[model samples]
Target: MPRKVLVAYGTKNGSTAQIAQIVAEVLSKAGLTAEALPARSVTSVSSYDAVVVGSGLYAGRWHKDARRFVRRHRRSLAPRPIWLFSSGPLDASASERDIPPVPGVRRVMDNLEVTEHVTFGGCLEEGAEGRIARMIVRSGKGGDFRDFTAIEAWAAHIAEELAGPESR
Candidate 1:
């Protein structure tokens, strides 16, 4: 049977959703059945072999829905291979080390034995901002800073890992 994977994300302004779609595509290419869904829509993951969850970081914290999903499904997710990612940091120069997941998020990582948590550069498009975001933009803190190549490479690596000895 084909391995099934779930790519769930919580996005603000849609960039993280695009990232999740790319991840699901990469997993599909690796011969795994994968689907990308918003965290809010996913009620259960018992049917999947693995799960990848991501969220847009806000002020160094994950989106509330993503956090809640992890909390709610912790038991169901514990037995599966799980990967976590955070999409944040509007600066192009931001590195993974510079954007570690928040403390609350880190707790889940430890509980799940997640080896690593990736932090990707974020995109903030014009006219997609709220009042505070607009104010930050006026201070020169906005643009499309996502590194697609990095995201793709990471997804491909996940696919390879999930593929196991047969694919290698």
Candidate 2:
């Protein structure tokens, strides 16, 4: 049976959710059973063999839901293979270079046995919520900076790690 992987994310404007979906798709294509869901919607992590948790970076902190999810499920999550991701850089900096996890995320990593963590570029389109998001969009600084190629590659690496050498 294929390993069941859950890709859970906390997103305010939906871009981070899109990234998580891409991750799940890549894992599924790599022969694992993967599902992506909003982090707040997940009631339990015990059913998944591995978990990928991601959150939108806001003010250098993870979204509240992501933080709560981790704290709520820490016990169930600690023994499982885990990966993490953050999406929120309004520029090409993320694609051009590695962006370390924000401090809050780093603390979470320190508490958990995270196998890997990645930061991807963010997206802010016309319909984004919040005053600052609207202001950024109006100023034309908000656009999609997500590198799908890089996102896919990262997910594939996770799959290969979870699926064993035979998967390669």
Candidate 3:
């Protein structure tokens, strides 16, 4: 049987949520069963074969709900194939390697033993953009800077990895 991958995320506005949906769509196109759902909509992960968690970064940390979800489900998630991502570092020419990890990500990295962790350039928009975006825009750093190709490639890689022998 094919594995069921859950792509869940927390977003202040909707950028991060949109990213998660894109990831799920890419993964599904690769022949996997993938669902992109908001963090709050996910109750029990018992049926998932793997998990992809994402959140927007603010104040040098992930959104509070993202952290809380991970903390609440750590034990249940530890044994699975888990991946993490943070949306941060507003519109810029910064390289992927240059995108800094959110503050609490260090502990999450250590604790979850996450299979993968990535950072994407954040977008700055008003009329509902979160605190982080407001700050970045106010500081003259807000813009849409995400690389869709890189994002799709990474999702494909995850799908390939999940199709391997061990994931079964």
Candidate 4:
């Protein structure tokens, strides 16, 4: 049977969710069974063979739902292969270079011994919630900086790792 992977994300403006969906699609295409769901919606992680958790960074912190999900599922997640991602750079920095996870995420990585973590560019369209988000959009600092190519490549790598050498 194919490995079941869950790509759970906490997103405020929906861009992170989109990134998670793309990652799930790539994993599925690579022969794993993958599903993307909101972190808050997931009641358990015990059923998945592997898990990919992602969150939209805000003020140097991950979304609240992502943080809560990790704290809630830490036990069930520790035994599984795990990957993590963050999206919240409103600039080209992520695409141009590697962006380290914020302190909070780093702590979680250490605790979970995550397989990998990545930072992708973020998007804040006009209708985004929050006064700051609207201000940024109106000030012309908001736009999609996500690199789909990089996102897909990372997901493919995860699939390859999960598939193992024997499968190759």
| TM-scores, each model vs. reference | 0.91, 0.96, 0.89, 0.96
Top-lDDT candidate index: 4
Q: Candidate 1 clashing pairs? A: none
Once fitted onto the true fold, the runs of candidate 4 whose alpha carbons sit more than 4 angstroms away are 165-168
Worst 10 residues of 3 by lDDT: 91-100
In what order do the candidates fall by TM-score, top score first?
A: 4, 2, 1, 3
Greater TM-score among 3 and 4 belongs to 4
63: Cα error in model 1, Å: 0.5
Question: What would the per-residue lDDT of candidate 4 be over residues 41-146, giving only the tens digit for each residue?
Answer: 9999988989999999999999999999999999999988889999999999999999999999999999998988999999999899999999999999999999
Q: What is the lDDT of residue 152 in candidate 2?
A: 95
Off by over 4 Å in 2: 165-168
Q: Name the lDDT of candidate 4.
A: 0.95
Residue-wise lDDT of candidate 1 within 1-168, one digit each (tens)?
339999999987899999999999988988889999999999999999889999988887888889989988999988888889988888875444556677978999999877467888888777765787777677778888888888888898888777776321
**Residue 53 shift from truth in candidate 4, angstroms:** 0.1
Clashing residue pairs, backbone N/CA/C < 3 A, model 2:
none
Q: Choose 2 or 4, whichever is better by lDDT.
A: 4
In Å, residue 35's CA in model 4 sits off its true spot by: 0.3
Tens digit per residue, CA lDDT, model 3, 1-168? 346899989888888888899899998998888999888778878888889999988777888778888888888889888888888677554344756466698788789888888888876676555564577677766777777777888898899888887663
In angstroms, the error of model 3 at 98 is: 5.0
